[model samples]
Target: SAAELLGDPAAYESMSQAANPYGDGRASHRIAEVLLHHFRGKPRPADWGGHA
Candidate 1:
C-alpha cells in the first residue's frame, strides 16, 4: 500500500515533501499559540518553546 502511493513519481514526491496531518515542526510559536488560545483557553506565552 505504501509502495503503491509511490507509483506516480510527481505525486509521491509532493506528498512525501508536503506538510503532515499534524502541525509543522518549524512553527513552534504558531503551534503554541494554537494550543493555548484554542485548545487551552490560555494566553499565548512569551517564550513559546524558544527558551534559552
Candidate 2:
C-alpha cells in the first residue's frame, strides 16, 4: 500500500534527501518569466532606451 511504502523511515529519509531530476525553484521563476513575456512582451524600461 502507499501508506506502507511511505511509512518506512529509511525510505522516507531517502526520498526526502533525493535530488530533483527535473529542476529546482529556479524552474518556477523561469516558467513565470515565460508566461509574463507571452502575455506582456519584453520589458524595456525608459531608462534603458535612452542612449545617445
Q: How would you encode candidate 1's per-residue C-alpha lDDT over 1-52 as one tens digit per residue?
A: 5776767787778777876666556577676687887787887555544422
Q: What is the C-alpha lDDT of each candidate?
A: 0.67, 0.61
**Deviation of model 2 at 18, angstroms:** 1.0
Q: What tens-digit string does per-residue lDDT give for candidate 2 at 1-52?
A: 4685578888777776788766564656666676677788965322322212
Please list the residue runs of candidate 2 whose C-alpha ends up more than 4 Å from where it truly belongs after superposition.
Answer: 30-52
Query: How do all models score by TM-score?
Result: 0.31, 0.39
Candidate number achieving the greatest lDDT relative to the actual structure: 1
C-alpha lDDT of candidate 1 relative to the true structure: 0.67
Q: What ranges in model 1 sit over 4 Å off?
A: 1-4, 23-52
TM match of model 2 to true structure: 0.39
By summed lDDT, the worst window of 10 consecutive residues in model 1 runs over: 43-52
